[model samples]
Target: MALAIFDLDNTLLAGDSDHAWLEFLSTLGIVDGEELRRANDRYYRDYMNGELDMGDFLRFVLAPMAAHPRRQLDAWHCQYMQERVLPMITDASRALVRKHADAGDTLLIITATNRFVTAPIAVELGVPTLLATEAECDDNGEFTGRSYGIPCFQEGKVERLRQWLGARGLPWEDSLSTAYFYSDSHNDLPLLELVGNPVAVDPDKILLATAQERGWPVLSLHGSCHPVT
Candidate 1:
């Protein structure tokens, strides 16, 4: 069966869930909210500029999970999903996902955002498989504020996907027949290139230029998700 993979932020959703999660937490007055916001904005700028320091950025993003209880964190995420993620999800994105599901393709979200922040959104999108960065935890099941393995950004995304497939005893060639990856950022170029169909969804200028040059299809999944084949 063909695989229909999606990038979480800016492709299916209208905004960045990682940044939004941090902003959502800020409203609760946790950990120097102003400074955290400034840093988060700076990192976002770096991401847009294609200069993301995945190592440092992940540490900052995951640190709070180490201190908070799992129960409280989950409750916060539920609220965050309702307040932040739900609005960002438009009718078009949902339609795109349903289109793939209807076609019987394996739907997955491959994002650099940590699983804790992006997992429920994957569920909200009705996608069953999510290949996202993982956070490590202590023996007691408390987060240790560290990444478990490779950071799922840039080339890391490709590696992680390969690893994911290998874990399922499936090889890359099997999925290459008609695999599709939908994304908006140049950061996703590695994985995008690996797929049979690399669709640019409301692309940033850099990816748009490359997509045009490469003759890849550019489509929008924002306003109203229509069937695109």
Candidate 2:
């Protein structure tokens, strides 16, 4: 079967789910609101500039979950998916995923966003596989405020995905055939280049330029997801 990978943040949805999740948490009064908001804002700035430190970013993102039980977090996430994420899953996004599903592709959502933040969205899209930054948990099943594996960002995305396929005994190097990855960020360029078919979905300036240069297909799930500058 052919492979179809999708980037979660701005590609499949209308906004950055990670940022939205942080906002969701901020309103719940679970974490220190001011501290969390400031850190999130700083990290988002770093991320936009492509200067993010994955270790620090993951720790910042996962810290609130450390204080809570998995069941509680899951409950909150269910609310989050219903309230925040569901609205962002536009008809165009669902159709894009369905197109691949109908083609019998091995669909995957590979995102830099953490599994806790993006997993439900993947489920909604009906994709069977997800490769996202993993949050580490302690012996008591509480988050440890650390990452479990390589953060799937930039070139790390390529490495982590290869490791994922290799561990499954899937042929890594030869698997790009009929492989397609749809993404919207310059951060995803490494993975976009690795796949045989790279589709730019409502791309940023850099990715748009690169996709044009490489003759990659351009697609739009909807209008620009970028916020007002």
Candidate 3:
């Protein structure tokens, strides 16, 4: 069966869900409002410029919760997912996910966001598998803000997705003929190039330029239920 991989941030939703989650966390007293806001602004600039290092990025996002118990983080994530992320899902993205699900294709969400945050979104979307960054935990189950595996961003995304496919006995070459990938950032170039159908959804300038150069189809789901041609 064909596999359909989706980028979760701006591609699937109107904006970065991670940023929204952080904003929500700030309200919940789990994260410092000023610190998170400043860090997020810097993160966005670095990410857009392709200058974000995986380790640094992970630490920047998770460092605030290092002192908090893991249980509290889990609770905050669940509440954030239900109250903020779930309601922000766009109809166009949801319909696309449903289309792939109804066709029996393997629907996967590949994101740089930690699994703790992305898992609930994947479940809500009915996606079977999520390939995301794994944060390390202490013996007592407290977060260390360190990665147990490769951070799922830039080239790391391609590496992890390939590992996931290999473990499932799916060959990248064989699947390329029917595989589909949807993304919004230039950082996803490696994975996007591996698929036969590369779609740019609400692409940023870099992604838009890359798509144009590669002749990939560009799709816009903003403010509409149907994809703009």
Candidate 4:
């Protein structure tokens, strides 16, 4: 079966889910509001500027929630998924996913967002596979604010994709024949180049310019109010 990989943040949703999740945690009083907000802003800046490492970013963002019970965090995650994230899934993106599903393509979400947050959204979209940053947990199910594997960002994303495909007896060459990738950032460049078709969805300026140079398809679903760059 052909593979269709989609990015989660700006490509699938209106904005960054990581930022939204942090904001949600603050609202629930699970995190220190001012500190988390400031850290999130710094992380966002560093991430866009290609300065922050994935592991560091995850630790920084999740540290505040580390003291909370795992069950409580999971409950909040479910509520956040239902209330905030679900409504943001645009009809156009849903249609794209549906078209791929109808074609019997292997739909997967490859995101830097944590799996705890993106898993429900993937299920809602009928995507069976998800490649995302995984947070480490203890035997008691408490988050360690650390990752067990490579955080799925930049080169780490490409590595995880390759590993996933390899485990399924599918190589990049085999997957690339009818493969498609949807993303919004230059950070996804490696996987974008590996796919047969690269679609830029509400891309950042760098990604848009690169896609333009390469003559890749570009799609903008949301209105002018949504930032495009």
Candidate 5:
């Protein structure tokens, strides 16, 4: 079976879960709405423009978890999933995932979002494997407001995926018939280029342009399947 790697944010879901999670917290009065919104928006814009400082962004995103008990954070996340994430999940996205699984492909969701935010979404989508930026936790199982290991953004995605494959005794080119990577952001271009089948899912302007120039398949999982050659 082939390896089907999917990006979780805009590729699989209709919106950015990390941003949505912060907005959800604002609604709950867990954070300073105006101040946090400004910073979040700036970071998001930076990310789209390929200028994000992952270290600063990670510290900002993980602070809430570090300040709260695990129980409280889990409670908030349960609500966040129901309220914010459920609406982002589209029928077409689910079908795409099911299509790959039905073909006996090994499904994996590789995202730059923190695992704390994307883990349940992976479970909800029934994808068995996920690689997300790790949120470091203290010995008591509470987040420490820091990220561990590689940030898993941009080129880091390719490095981490290589490590994952190597650990399983799998060679990059010979083990699978093909490796399919579906992504929407240009930030994932590194991993996308490394895969045999790089499909752009409702791509951003930069990614769409690159996909067209490179003759990669462009697909829309947000609605009816629109395939561009």
Candidate 6:
């Protein structure tokens, strides 16, 4: 069976989870709503332009998790899932996932979003594997506001996936033969190029152009979800 890898933001989901999480926190008054939103918007713009500084963005996003207890963060995340994330999940996305499943392809969701925010969403999608940027933890099992290892973005996604495959005794070259990666951002081009089949789902402007030039399949999973930006 082939491997199907899906990007979390704007591909399988209708929107960016990292941005939504921060917005949820701002609305709860956990962080300064106006300030965080302005900064978030800036980072998001950078991301859309393919110029995001992952280091700075991670620090900004993870700081709030560092300040709060795990229990409290978990509670807020539950609410965030119900209010923010659930709506982003759409029937089209679910059907795409099922399409891969019915074909006996291994399902994986890999995203630049941190694991704390995405793990549950993976569960909701019924995808059994996830590769996400890991947030560091302290001795007390609390977040340290730092990322662990490499942030899974751009070229790093290729590295992270390679490492994951190596750990599972799947050789990098061998796995690529049957691998299919679906993404919407130009930033994912590195991994997309490495896979056997790369599908652009509701791709951004730059990615759409690249996909067209490369003769890659362009898909639209925005059937019932919010229109992909």
| Pairs with steric clashes in candidate 6 | none
Q: Write the per-residue lDDT of candidate 5 for residues 65-142, one digit (tens) a residue.
A: 898899999999999999999999988888889989998999999988999999999999999999999999989999
lDDT of 3 at 137: 81
**Would you estimate the TM-scores of all the predictions?**
0.94, 0.92, 0.93, 0.93, 0.96, 0.95
Tens-digit per-residue lDDT, 1-229, candidate 3: 6889999988776677778877997897778899888887888898899888767877777775686787888888788877888777878888889888888898999999888778888888888899988978888888887777878898898889889889989887887778999999999998888889999988889999999998998887666534632
Give Cα distance to truth, residue 47, candidate 2, Å: 1.8
Clashes of 6: 0
Q: Top model by lDDT, which number?
A: 6
**lDDT ranking, best first:** 6, 5, 1, 2, 3, 4
Model 6 lowest lDDT segment of ten: 220-229
- What do the candidate models score in CA lDDT, each in turn? 0.88, 0.84, 0.84, 0.83, 0.90, 0.92
| Model 6 lDDT per residue over 1-229, tens place | 9999999999989899998998999898888988887997899899988899999999999999999999899999999999999999888888889988998999999999999999999999999999999999999889999999989999999999999999999989879877999999999999998899999999999999999999998888876333323
Query: Which residue pairs in model 2 clash with each other?
Result: none
Candidates 1 and 5 compared: the better one by TM-score is 5
Quote the lDDT for 131 in model 4: 97
Q: Give candidate 5 misplaced runs (Cα > 4 Å).
A: 175-177, 225-229
RMSD of each: 1.7, 3.6, 1.8, 2.9, 1.8, 2.6
What are the runs in model 4 whose C-alpha is more than 4 Å off? 224-229
What candidate 3 gets wrong by more than 4 Å, as runs, is: 225-229
